[model samples]
Target: MTANPTRLGAIRTIEASEAPAAFFDVTEKTGAIFGENVFSLSVMQKRLPKSVFRSVYATIQRGEKLDPAVADIVASAMKDWAMERGVTHYAHVFYPLTGLTAEKHDSFMEPVGDGTAVWEFSGKTLVQGEPDASSFPNGGIRATFEARGYTGWDVQSPAYILENPNGNTLCIPTIFVSMTGEALDHKTPLLRSEAAMSEQAQRVLALFGHEDIDKVVSYCGPEQEYFLVDSAFVNSRPDLLNAGRSLFGAKPPKGQEFDDHYFGAIPERVLGFMHDTERALFRLGVPAKTRHNEVAPGQFEIAPVFERANLASDHQQLLMSTFRSIAKQHGFECLFHEKPFAGVNGSGKHVNFSFGNGNQGNFLSPGDNPHDNAQFLVFCAAIIRAVHLYGGLLRLSIASAGNDHRLGANEAPPAIISIFLGDQLQDVFEQIAGGGATSSKQKGVLSVGVDTLPDLTKDAGDRNRTSPMAFTGNRFEFRAAGSNQTVAASMVIINTIMAEALDFLATEIETSVKGGTEFNAAVQAVLAKVVEQHGAVVFNGNGYSEEWHVEAEKRGLKNLRTTVDALPEYQSPEARKLFTTYGVFSEAELESRFEIGLEQYVMTINVEANLTGEIAKTTILPAAVRYQTELATNVSALKAAGVDADTADLLRVSEMIAALRAGIGALDDAKATGHDHEGLAEAAYYRDSVLPAMLQIREAADEIETFIADDLWPLPTYQEMLFIR
Candidate 1:
C-alpha cells in the first residue's frame, strides 16, 4: 500500500527538483569576470615589477627555459595576489598517470618565533612539491618503499583561485615525476612531446621560407559528454554509486530509439546546473562555448573553444571537477562513465586538435584549394603518415575498460583506428597517390529553399561522426577519447607520432631536393610516396560498417578492440622508438604506463564484476522473490478453487531466478580465476571471462525488472531515472 523504503531516494530527488536554483550574477561583461580568479598575464603585469613580469611572460610565450632567479619574483607576485584575495593556502596540482588530478595543499602561514604566523611562499616551494610517490598508480615504476615524487610548476598553465564554501585556495598546475626522471604523470610527456613536434614543425616551416615562428603548440577543444541523474535514483542503485553505471537496469521501452533527445531542449534542473558550471568555468578563464542535450535521454554535452593543449588538458580535468561539485548543488550526480546506462548511446570526449605557431594560424588548415597549397598538403600528409605508422598507438591511447562499453557500438567509432579526410580531402589524397593532386573541390552556396534567408556556403567536406579521426575545416577531431580519460595521453601520443612522421617526410623532401630535384617536385614526390604507402589508413566510409572492419583487417590496419589488446602496443618496438626519438617518454616511462593501464583495466572490471554479483544477490533477488511469492500464492488459491490458472508467470519467475543465481555463481568463479592470474593475463581474464559473467547477471536481472511490480522494485527504473524530473 505504501512506497518502498528505498523510495526515499526518489522523494529526495523530487524535492531537489522543486527547489529554486541559486543564480550566478554577471554584473558587467566578459571583461569583468573573465580571468577574475586566474593568475593571468594581465594580473601579473599589474602585480609584478615590469621587468620580472616580461621575463616570465617571454619564457611562457617563447617556450624558453625558465630562469631560476626570476622564480622568486614570480612566486612573490603570485603569493601577494592570492593573499590579497583571502587565500590562505596553495596547492600544487598535478595530473598523475591514473588519469586524475592529485594535489598537495600547503598553508601560507609558516609560524614565526612569536606564536604568530607569517605569510610566506618562496620560489623553492612554488617550483617543487614532494607528495607520496608510492601512493599513486605508477605501473611499478617506483617501489612501495620509494616515496620521492616531485611536482614542478608548469608555468604555461596559469595559477587560479579555487573557491569553496569555507575558504579559497590558489591552485598551481604542475608536472609530476619520479626521482629517476620517469614521467609519473601525463603532463610531463605532453610538454616534452609538444617541444619535439614544435622542433620538427619549425624545420618544415623553414623549408617553406618562414622565419618568425614561435613554438608550435597543439590546441585542444574537447566536447565533454556526461549523464545526469538525480541523487535519489543514484543513491538507490549501488551499481551507479560503486561502478558508475547501471549494472542491471532494463532498457526503457522508449529509449533514444526515436532520436528525439539529441539536441533537444534542456531540462530546467539540468539547464540551471549547466549555467552555474559554465559561470564557474568562465571565472577560471575556461572558454566554455557550447552546451546541449545529447543523444540519450539523460545525457548532455559541453564544449569549450580550443586552448593550448597543455592548459586545455589541465582545464579539462578542472572542468570535470566543476561538473561534479556544481551538479551536486543542483541535486544531480554527474556520470562521466562512458556507458552509464545500457541500451543507450554513451559518452565520449571528442578532442578537436590543431596546432599553430605565432603568426602562422592553424597548420592543419587545408585551404580552399588544398592542392595549390603545398605547405598545407605537406602538413596534411604528415598526419596521414603519422596515423598510418602509429595507428595502433592512437588506438591504444584512447583504450580503457569504461570505453570498451561504448566503442564499436555504432554510436561511437570502431576499434579500428583510421583517418577520415572527408570527400574533398580524401579525393585530393587519392589524386596524389595516383600521381599528384591538381584541382580541389570548392564549397557552393545553398539556398535552403527559402528566399528570406541568406544563402549559406556548404563546407566542401561533410562531417563524419563515426570516424575516429576526422579532419574538420581546420582541425582533426579525435572522436574516440573516453569522457573520463585525460586528453594529455591522447595529445602526447599524437604529438610524438606527428613529430616522427614530420621528420621522416622532411628528410625525404630534403634528400630529393639536395639530389637536384626541384623543391616543389620534391614536396610532390614525398606527398605521393606518403599517400601511396599510407593511404590505406584513410577511409571516409562508415567505420561502423562490417565491410569496413573486414577491409581494415585485410589492409593490415590494427583493430585494438579492448584495453588489453591495445595496451601491449604501447610497448611495441615501434612505439618505444617513436616516443624515445621525440624524448617524450623513455623506455622505462612508456613501459610503466603500459603496466599501469593493464592494472587499471583489471581493477576496474574486477570491481564491476563483484558489484554485479553483490547487487544481484542482495537488491535484485529479494525484489524478484517477493514478487514471485505474491504471484505463486495467488495462483495456488485459484488452482485450489478449481479454476484454471496460467502457470506462465510462475514458470518465468522460476527460470529467471535460476538464471540470476547462476550468473552470480559464474561471476564469483570468474573473479577468483582472474585474481589467480598475473599481469596482462589477469586483464585478459577480466575482459574475456569476468565481463561475460557480469553480462549474464545483467541479462537475467533486467528481465526480472519488467515482471516485478513498480513499488516492489527497490532501485529506480531506467524510465524514472532517465525521464523523470
Candidate 2:
C-alpha cells in the first residue's frame, strides 16, 4: 500500500512528518531564469530568423493561420530551449471537458541502430499530437471504437516547462478535438468563440474609424478566491478529505460575524505560501497582480492582470494546479469548493472582462461624455442585448453542483443575471432609453477641505457587488463564476453571445444606412432599439433581497436556481441556434456538452452522497452512540446512588441520539435506492431526493458535534481547522 519509492526523488516526502523546509532554493544565478524554461517571445526572437519570427508574431497577434514553413523553425527553437532546461519529454497540454487540464507525455529520445539514443523533436511532434479519445470524456463526440483525438498547438499561448522530481517536460498549450473534427475540450470552443467575437468586434470598430485594427480580443482578469486549511486537520476530517468541503461541521461560534477577517493581516504561513505561489506564477509569465485576505476566515483571493481571454483561461487552470502543488509544500490544503465552510462567505472567481484591439482602444470606454459617445453606447447596448437574450446560457455556463451551494447566498451573486451600471451610467442608459438627447458633462476636479490636500480626479461611479454583472469603469465584472470553475466555460459563453449581438447590430446599422438614414441617426436607432428590447436586464439594486427576486420574476427573467434547473437550458433550441450561428459549437457539440455537464452534476452529488453515508456510518454514528451510552450509564449510576444527576441534560442528549439514528436510517434508505444516471431524471433525483437526505444527516451530525465532549468528537472542529494557521 506504500507509494512507489522510485516516485520519491531527492525531495524528502513528508511522513508522520513536520511541515516542509521553510524555503525552496529557486536560483538567481540565471537571473533570467524567470522565463528561461518557456518557449517565449524572447526565446523565439533569439532562435528564429527575423522573417520567421515576424510571421509567427503576426499569426499570434492577428489570429491568422500559422505558416507551415515557420512551424519547423518554431519547433526547432522550442526543442532547443527545452533541451537546454533539462527537459527530456514533451506534452501537448490541453483543457478537457472534465474542467481540468490533461496531458500525455512522450519522451524525446529516439533510438539509433546500436544501443544508443539521441533526443529529437520535430515540427510534427510540436505542432500536433494524437492521444486516445476513448479514455477522455468526449460526450459522445467520439465513439469508443473511434479512439483518435488531436491536440493542435495554440501558438498564441507560449509553451512552458513543467518540472517535477520525476522528470522535466515541455508543455505546449494546445486545443483538443476529436477525429471527426468535433471539439472535445473547453479550449477549442473558446478559441472559436474568440474568433467569432474578434470578427464582429472588428466590424464594429471599423464604424468608429478604427480600420487599422485587424482584430479585437475580449480580455479577462479573474479574481480567484479560495481557502487554506491545515493538511493534518483536512486529512483527519473524512468529509473534507472526500468532498473538498466539510459536509457535517457545526458553524463555529465565531465565524466572520464581526467582519474582522476581511482585509485582516495575513498569517505568516499563508503569506509564505502566497509569496512562493506568486514567484512561481511570475516565472511562468503569469501576471499575478493582487493578493488579499477575504471576508471568511481562512479565505483569501489572488487576482491576475488582464490578458486575452484564451491565455487568461489557460493561465487560470495553470494557476489552480500550481496552487495545489505549492500549498502541499507549505503544509496546507487549498480548497476551491464554492462553499467550503457553513455560515460564512464562500469563494467566487470574479471575472473582469473587456473588449479591446491591438491599439489599446477599449470599445466599452466612455469618453468625456459616456452618454454622447455613440460608439461606446452601441457597444454597451450590444452587451445588454446579449445578456438579455441569453441569460439562461450565462447561468448554465456557471452552473455546477458545488456552485449551487454558493449562488443566491449572501456571499455571491443571485441566480438572476442583471446588470448594475451604478448611478451615473444608469442615468445615461435611462436617458438613451427615453429617447432624450444627452450632452457631455464638464469634468470636475475635487478640492480637499484643506489646501494641503492635492486635487483629485474621481471615477464616474461606485462598485455594486450585489449585481451579477457590473460595469466597473472599462470592464464588466461577471461575479457569478465559482472559484473551482475553469474560466473557459464562462468566457466562451460571454464571447459567443456578444459576438451574435454585435453581428445583429452591424447588420441593422448597415441596413439603415442603405435605406437613406444618416450614419449618426442609424447608430442612434440601433442603440435605441437595443435599449428598448433588452433594457429589462439592467437593475441597479440589491439582488440578494427578496424584493429583487419578485421584481426579477415580474420582469420575466428566468431564475434557474440549481445545476439541475440551469443545465437543461444549454440544449434548448435557442442555445443551439445562438452557438451554431456564431460557429462556436455545432449542434452535436452542444448536445455533447449538455450530456457531459449533466453527467458531471450527477457524479458530483453522488460522490458527496456516498461520502456522507460513509462518514456517518463509520465515524459519526459510532461516536454519537458511544457518547450517548456513557451519558446514559452515568445518569443511571447517579440515580441508583440516590444522587440526582442533571436529568434535563440526559433527556436532551437521548432525544438528539434518537434523532441521529433516524437520520442515519433515512440516509441508508436513500442510498439503497440507487441513482439512475441515464438522463435529467438522474439530476433531479440527486437534487431533490438524495441531497435533502444528505443535508438531514449533516444537520444531525453537526448538532451532535456541538453537544459532544471534545474528547468524544471524532473529527476536527471548525474552530480548530479555521483558526489553526
Candidate 3:
C-alpha cells in the first residue's frame, strides 16, 4: 500500500547514476588495443631470439610441453615486456576447486645491495610457484597440515597483464597441483582431457586419408547470461550481497511473461556497461563478440568468438571478474547466480563446442552433401555413441546446487542429457540406421513479399532451444551448463567421453579395413551399428515435455535431478575407467573430485539455510510483527468507537506471522541438525531436510511480505530489483 524508503532510495540512486565515460581514448582504435596487454605469439616473436622464439611458439601453437632450456629466455622476455608497462608484480593465476580464480602475487622487484632494486623473474619462478594446498579444497588429495601446492605454467594459455589504477600485474595462467602431483584445480583436468581427445581425433583424421595433421584442439565459445541490478539495491539486501541471489522474493506480476525482453533493445545503461567490459576483455584478448538482451528483465548475454578450450576457460573466468568490477564502476552488480529471481527465466552459459585441427576443419561439420560425407557421418556417429554411453556423465558435469533450481524449469535444459539432431541430420542418421543413406536434404530459399526485399537463404534444419545438447550447424551448444560455473568441468567430461568414442570408432574402422573390407563400407558398417545402439540418446522433440520424461525413462535414460543424485556418478566404475584409460584423471584424482563436489553441495545449502533464518529473524520477522501490531491496534480502536469493523485483515496477518516464526525455527533446527553426516550423506541431508525447510521459510516469509505494509518491508522486493533498472 505504501512505497518503502529503501526501494525508493535505490530507484533514485539508479536514476541519478550515469554510464561511465569511454574506457579508451579516441586515438586508440579497438583493433589496436586488442591483445596489446597479452604476451602473444607476435609479442614473443618480436622479443625473443629466433631460435628461442621458435621453441616457445612450438609450445603455444602445437600444445607441446615447454622445453626447460627455453624457460630462462622466455621468462626474461616476459619480464622485460611487463616492466615496460609499469608492472611491478606477477601472479600465477589458477582455478581452484572453489570454482573461482586464485592467485599468489610476488613482486618482481628484488633488493640488490645498498637500497638498490632490480626487476627479476627467474625461469624457475615462471615455471613454478608455491601456494598453500591445504587452504584450497583438495578433497582428500592433501592433508590439512600438508600445505604444499604448485602452480605450473601453461604455455599454451598466453600470459596477460592486468591493469590497476596504482600498478599492474603480469598474470600467468597456470594449473594448480599438489606436491604429490595430484590435480587440485579445474585447469589440470581440462588440459589432460584435451590432450586425450586430441590424440584420438588425430587417429580418426588419419583413418580418413589425412596425411599430416595438426594437433587437434577442442574449441569453445560460451554464451554467458546474467542479471544486472543497481548496487544500491544489492547493498541494502543482505541475502543478495552474501548469497549472490535473493533468498526470498515474491514473484513479480510482470516477470518475463510477454516475451518482450528477449532480444529486445539494449538499455542505454547496460550498453555502457557492456562497452566498458568489452574494451577490458579486448585488451586481454578475450574476443568478446556478441551482446544482447536475454529472456528476463535486466538479464543480458555476451558471447566470445571461438578459442582453444584452455584459453577459452581462462578467458571466461576473466570475463566474469571483469564484468563484476566494470559493473561496479557503472553502479551495477552483475548477478551470475542461476535463477537469481524465481518465476523468471534463469541464466545459463551455453558452451558452443567443436573440435578440429589445422589440417582438417571441424570434425562435426556435415558439409552440403552430408549423406555422402562418410567422414562427417563417422564423427557425428561418434558423438551419438559418446552421449549414449556417457549421458549420465554429461548430466553430472553441469550438476550444482544453483543449477538444480534451473534445470528442467523450462528456461534451461532438462537433466536428462540427449543430443538434438535437427531434421536434416536426423533423417541422415535414420537412413544409416535402416541400412545406408543415399540422399541429403537441401536448403530452401525464403522469398519476401516485398519486391525491394531480396530472397533469404534458409538453413537446412531448424534450431531447438529446449534440448540439452543441440546440434547448431557445425557445433553442439551445451545449454545445460550454469552461468556461474567454470566451463572447464563440463568441457572435461565432453572431451574425455568424445575421446573414448573416437578411439573406439577408429579401432573398429581400422580393424575392418585391415581385414580386407572396403574403407567406405567399413565406415558405413561401424556408423550403422553405432546408430542402432546409440540412437536412443538423440531426441529432437521438446525436452521440457512430461511425455519426454516418460519416454526418456522408457529409453533407459537416468534422470539424475539433483546434484546429490548426479555427483555419485563421479565414483562410478565407468567414470573411473574412462578417466583412467584416457589418462585424464587418476583413481585418486577421481575420488578426490567426488569428495570435493559433495562437500561443495552441502556447504552451499548450509550457507543459504543460515542466511534464510538470519534474515527472517532479524529483518522480516520484526517488520511483520510491527505491521501485525498496527492492524490489531486499528481493529481495537475501531471496535472501541462502537462501529462494526472487519477483523479479517488483522486475523490473516496474525496467522502469517505465526507461520513465519514456525518456519524460521524449523529452518534453524534443520541447519543445526545436519552436521553429523559427511560427504554424500551430508549433501543428501541438506537436499532432503535443509532445502525443504528453507523453502518453507521462504513461502511463509513471502506470504508475510504480501500482507505487510510495503513501507515496513526491510528488504527490496523482486519487482524493484528486477525491473527498476
Using TM-score, give the best candidate's number.
3
Residue-level lDDT of model 1, residues 1-725, one tens digit each, is 22665775576547656644554684647668878999999999898888888888887899988888888888998999998888999999999977888899999988888898788999999999998889898888899999999999989999999988778999999999999888899999999999999999988988888988888889999999999988878888898999898888888889998889999989887888887888899899999999999999999999999999999999999999999988887778999999999899999999999988778988988878998989888988999999988989989888999999899999899989999998888888888878888899999888899888999988887999889999999899999999999999899989998899889988998888889999999998999999889989999988999999999999999988888999999778998888887899888888888898888898888788888888888889998999899989999999999999998989899899999999999988888778788888888988889999999998999999888787888888888889876
Q: Once superposed on the true structure, which residue ranges of model 1 sit more than 4 Å away at CA?
A: 1-5, 8-12, 19-23, 26-28, 640-642
Task: For model 1, give the 10-residue run with minimal summed lDDT.
Answer: 19-28
Residue 354, candidate 3: how far off, in angstroms?
0.5
- Residue clash pairs of candidate 3: none
lDDT score at residue 241, model 1, on the 0-100 scale: 94
> Largest lDDT belongs to which candidate?
3
Between prediction 1 and prediction 3, which has the larger lDDT?
A: 3
The estimated TM-scores of all candidates read 0.98, 0.95, 0.99
What would you estimate as the lDDT of candidate 2?
0.85
RMSDs, each prediction?
A: 1.5, 4.3, 1.1
| Clash-forming residue pairs, model 2 | none
Ranking by lDDT: 3, 1, 2
